[model samples]
Target: MDKLTKGTWILNTTKHIVDVAQKSTELNYFETTALAGKTGVFLSKLVADKQEVITYEKVKKFARESSIDNNNRNVKMHLDLLKEYGKVDYNTKLTEVEVYCFSNEDAIETTADIYSNEIVDEDEDINIYSLEETYNVPRKREELVNKLVNNGYSEEKVNLAIKIQDTFGLIKVADNILYNEYTFTGNEAKMVKTISNISSSKKKDIEEVINRISNNQGLIENKITSDINPEIVKLMEGIGLIDGITVTSEIGEATFYTSPHIKGKGIKEKDFSLADDVFHKAKILLSCLRFGQEKSTYGRGKIDTRTKMLNIIRKLNRGEWLNPCTAVGQDYKLLEVDGVVRVRAFGNRFQMSLRQKEVGILVEKMILNNSIDTTDDMGDICSLEVQPSGIIIPEVRRQQMKPKEIGLVKELRDEMLTILRT
Candidate 1:
């Protein structure tokens, strides 16, 4: 793991449930904050009203107006969560208790300053902020505690510091293993929280395995799950962090664990600059790769439908024409209806191939690389979600092609086809 510098951890901001739901459009500051529920609304008001310095009495008033639980304890708990996020600075030692809200950057800097100011004499060297540098890699809690104790800090102080940082979401403890929460981003934070809340003895083992696999990418399922606990692999797959796909060829069958995040290495921007029909067909195939039914007439009873689909995609990628009646059967019909494959009359038999070769290559890259960007032209999302059984079910949405863009696509397609035929 790379070492992190203090105040330079590049912390990722968490999305409230509302933010995730309404991320399609730009939101004003107040709307963004208010939609996060009472805490967001409270922070919005504090910032909007220039309440840089606040009091507990004023906090209670805001809580009542915002329809929060509004009790002395609940309000303070909310305040603490906000303080941990570096959204507010509250002085615990003051007689009157002051809460300060600075600009986004200043709030974090101020929080670090506040923590630094409150440290005891013996704990001058290693504070919560400096801990980011050391705890970049996940470690068992006892291991971390022992490491810190060996460095001269009291066990009591080390534990207290860990708890405080955990409360702020800076450090996360899952399965009794301490993880730097800054290591996760976007929906990954939700996965971390889910892991934290679940009751399991295998979580520590799961983290270790994930750490190992992350270091060595492109391992097969058997290689990963053979020695480790099956339940742990199932849980990790269920949470959508790790996934595997079984691909079949004439030679044999093997399953490879693929990264959920796709890189789209061989795909280019011009690949999407083709005809709208080609783009739309590619979009359907990508969606089918994620949302299509898992069991079908073509695949074996025990094999996954995705594996069957990938086999067809692999054949198409090789430019071999398939006969709908003999070679691919009903699978071709399903993809034809989905607009991902083209079925046309060839001599005396019906033939099927991908709608466009370029589009087929795009799908191939998506499967091979694991991450591709189609948000602009295809409206297909790169993120994935899986059931506890490890079946992927990504959200589906389609964008309508603009009239002007449609003509451009047609012109480009004609030009490319003419050049290729020559």
Candidate 2:
């Protein structure tokens, strides 16, 4: 890639990427993977006026480096998480996510409601495993495989993972990606049930439908177990699935799926695909988790995509790039439109929205804070300040509050109130 031209720097001299990077135990800063975490820790410190930097290149390089290098391994991952969430930050760790689920709003009959079946109701709170739950630890995977193998699992199935790990390393266990093959636990029954119910005239339709939609595997299996009729068995067998799909009748207590890779063992969603850019995007989203104001409907997926985007942005900046800025969440899009990036977390998304419009005011003020730049007059470059006149209380508020203090009566009736009151 061509190095970013010098012209970019002149665009915004106040941008400070070097300081955004965490001080390195090795040299200038911690690797890019650690940037998001550092950014998360210091997010509160950044002000609307201060320039926030997120390095795309060193971060991207660090991601690629961690994937390849075995030596810096200890420093590479957070001990508590024990897995790389592609490139997620500390906030993602704290943010709650949703389990894979389905919408139940359209169901006409309450009888159709199965307790354990995946269903999302409007505004109902649901819990989801974090990205860390979705990913496998590099060390733990090794230990699990060894324990499973020694316990007499078929060498074929156990070694399938072994072969995967040997060639692809950690990616294989986490994503089940191999040479044009993928694997997951307990997906066979659901794949079977869905296929067997196909009508004679709807074979193409059934298969086509199967090509789309990732059913929460556990849900389908739960449905199959509770209502297995003879017809369901025939339907199950025709789809190459055998009976033993275990699920409980327990209706709803909000249990989340533990497995991230399995959609059902035998069936894969052939209809869906993530573009290479999207895949990279997904990777970054997986790396950086959300810290604040992500709802259940958009929570998990948003965190995934955003993490992916930030990591890529951080990586791309490794070369000489312009005075680019990136912030934690969607709350910064308004500020972003003004040629500023908000890489720091700003509490919650709601608070983020509140401050976005004041970017120009904040940037100017931030420039003044550093007091680093000097003008031709030998004074601060942003010497001009807009000190706000104290706000006069509104008449409506004065009427509503009906101040208990006597000072309020004179101040409200005389010195204060909107000009309309006079």
- Give lDDT per model, in order: 0.42, 0.24
- What ranges in model 2 sit over 4 Å off? 1-179, 182-206, 210-275, 278-343, 347-422
TM-score of 2: 0.19
Residue 202, candidate 1: how far off, in angstroms? 7.6
Q: Using TM-score, give the best candidate's number.
A: 1
Alpha-carbon error at 43 in model 1, in Å? 40
- Superposition TM-score, candidate 1 onto the true structure: 0.27
Shift of residue 341 alpha carbon in model 1, Å: 0.9
Residue 142 in candidate 1 has what lDDT? 82
Give the per-residue lDDT of model 1 (tens digit) for 1-422: 12112222321112111223345332222131222234543443344113445456665765564445678787777677667666666667521334445222333233234323432343323343334533344566787788888877899877766664454344545446555422222123333454454344555665666555444333445667778865555434432345444433333334444333332446443432111221123434554353332322222221133344456566776766553343333334434433245556655445666534555665566555532223222121111122112211111000111122234333332232222222
Model 2, global lDDT: 0.24
* Per-residue accuracy of model 2 over 256-289 as CA lDDT, tens digit each: 1112122323224452221111111111111111
User: How many clashes show up in model 1?
Assistant: 3
